[model samples]
Target: MTLEGKHALVTGGGTGIGLAIARDLAAKGAQVTITGRRQEVLDTVAAESAGLFGLAMDVRDEADVIDKVAAAVAERGPVQVCIANAGIAEGRAVHKMDLAFWRNMMATNLDGAFLTIRESLKSMRETDWGRVIAVASVAGLRGLPGAACYTASKHGMVGLIRALSEDYLGRPITFNALCPAYVDTEIVDRNTASISQRAGVSADEAREIMVSANRHRRLIRPEEVAAAAAWLVSPGSESVNGQAIEIAGGMM
Candidate 1:
């Protein structure tokens, strides 16, 4: 049950779901390296939590991801648990979406996950056991209206994990994605404003729309997603490979 010797890496670990997962892993005795674009934000969080080290790195930049992950490995040993949680979510109708918006969405949500996992695997492959978990969205499983690019990017993440699972079938490492419905994070807050402006609704009504989208009629908590990530690395989940575990209130 203890990850005393394990080293975990979480991208976008400065806030929201990533921070929750990072703190949870650290509490479980893993030395967690938390990466984000802002050094000050990461440093503040690291200072408040034991076993959590802050590293400033941008997932969208290949060289930054490579060198930063290498630096973390140099300091804390190989990353035994890698979480690709850095992403961006924006909703725009297909007809209204420009190439710039679509590309930026893919770059952060899809390309970022690819780079994070590819770099982490370099060290994780040398270890006896490892875990790679991506914080994808429920949109990964089903098409979502008004967010075509976001949905497509998440679908790519789920496919990546599934394919990697097949490639490493007999290995001790497990690849998986945590698909959660509208979690109560900063992203949701931003989305609420965006939705309100677009739909000509009150901010509260916009937020309520998301809360009602969940089958259980409530936004999810970041800690709920973190719990799923924690369980994936636990000794009991050895056979849970390539699964897109949903934290949604109910099946989509």
Candidate 2:
């Protein structure tokens, strides 16, 4: 589907699934604005996509999010497509999790999404159409061991999307969440190391453990999730509102 002239914004768009989605949107003729904490990573991705603009902003910072999104809209027009994909994935058992760890996850995954969507909606409401997509995880759908904080954060994001969908029922906008399991990204690499150290297992074993987390017994490609994001923005998906489309290889 063509998104010609549409302006799309993706948070954490520097790498992994966010970068993949940003590239897909850019290829489909949308002027994409990608935001991340690091300018270097954003620059690298922006270099590869002609219409993609990179902005250095941290989603976890409320003021920064407000300023950057406003700037993006001023430069590229309204954000018809907003993807709340900035997040932190960390696993810590509930009892052992400190307040700082829990707060960080909640701030990045939940608060960041709220700020991003809220700010974008201001400009989007003035337009005729809009799409808000949140990149949740399988953890959002169910509890995973040693990931209480992470799961809670994702679950909160899905909750926010669902509530917004209902609040704007008749509006020309859609809110949805994409839930994927064990995607092959930097988060997985970090988790592998953590698991290996925590469980006293070899790194290979830790990797296998994550691969087995998915029902398909394999790690998902970032492109797979990106394809799902693309579909959500396609014309055929106009009726697919308030849904959490899981990409966990039949795990759902």
Candidate 3:
């Protein structure tokens, strides 16, 4: 159960689910590189864990992903586990959405995941084994109300992972996605405020709206997703490809 010599990269690893996964990989003896747009946040978190290195990189920018990831490989080794986890989530009705809003959602969620996976694969494919995991949303499997743009972007992310899985079916590399609902992260905390402002409700009331979406009627912890990620990259997960594993406490 040791990834003693593996090199891993997690995009948007400064906080939330990405950070949890990065820490877990580091704990398992992988030289993990955590990337995000915020340097301070990355530095702060990386210091708390062994084998975790923070590099400030934006997933939405192609040049940044290519150069930074290449540098990470040179400093450590080829990336054997690539987690395309950087993304943004927001809710807005279709009729009221502007072009910037729509494009912003797609650019960060779908385009960012694509760029991260493609760049990481440059080094990952050089190795005999690899894992590519996309942190998609439960919304990807079903239409989310008042979030058409977000739903579309996640669907694209899931589609990309599925297609890549089929293309690399016989290879040692595997592609999969984790679709979680109502994670108890900063994103949900912020969304509560946004929902309150938009819908004229109390922040607590708005938060409950998201919490109730989960079948368990509670927000999920970040470590739960990290556990799944650790399993996917472990030695025996070669057959677990092209799956969008839902973590919503029940079937969707």
Candidate 4:
């Protein structure tokens, strides 16, 4: 279907799943504003894509989120498709975790999503149709060993989407969360190294541990997740609200 005049805003759109979704929306004729902490990264990606525009904004900061999203709306019109995808993942055993680590995880993964969607909704509310998607994780549905904080943050994001979906029921807007298992992103690369150092294993072994965690025993591609996001905003997705759609290989 064509999103000819729709405006989309994707946080962390500089790379990985966010970039894939941003590109997908742009390909479908939406004017996409891709935001990230690094302006250069966003600029480089925007320069390479026709309908993608770069806007540097930190999701963890409420004022920044409000200002940047307003600027984007001013330039591209209302954000008809809002992708709250900016986040960070790290694994720290509960015993070893500190207040700072927990706070940072919540700030980036949970609070960031809340701020991004809240700001996007301001503009989206004026439009007749809109899609709000949160890039949550399988951990949101089930606990992930060794990453309690990350799991909790994802759970919070999923909860936010579900509540918003209910709040906007009967409206032409839908809210959903994409719960994927171990997508092949830079976060996984960093986690692999961290796991290797902490688990006394080789990098390949650490990576294998993650790959094996998936029911299908493989790492998910970012594009696969992007496809799910694309479908959620398509013409026939109006009834798929208040749901946590898992992109995992199989039921986990």
lDDT of 4: 0.94
lDDT winner between 1 and 2, please give it: 1
Model 4, span 216-251: residue lDDT tens: 999999999999999999888889999999988998
How far does residue 205 in candidate 4 sit from its true spot (Å)? 0.3
lDDT of each: 0.95, 0.93, 0.93, 0.94
Q: Clashing residue pairs, candidate 3? A: none
lDDT of 3 by residue, 87-184 (tens): 99899989999999998888889999999889888888888999999999999999999999999999999999999999998989999999999899
Relative to the true structure, candidate 1 has a C-alpha RMSD (angstroms) of 0.7
Question: What residue runs in model 2 are displaced by over 4 Å at the alpha carbon?
Answer: none
Candidate 1: tens digits of C-alpha lDDT, residues 1-252: 789999999999999999999999999899999999999999999997789999999888999999999999999999999999999999999999899999999989899999999999999999899999999999999998999999999999999999999999999899999999999999999999999999999999999999999999999999999999989999889999999999999877
lDDT (10s digit) by residue, model 2, range 83-181: 999998878788888899988899999999999999999999999999999999988889988888999899999999999999999988999999999
Q: Which runs in model 4 stand beyond 4 Å of their true positions?
A: none
Q: Against the hidden true structure, what lDDT does model 1 obtain?
A: 0.95
Q: Order of all candidates by lDDT, from best down to worst?
A: 1, 4, 2, 3
Clashing residue pairs in candidate 4 are none
* Residue 55 lDDT (model 1): 95
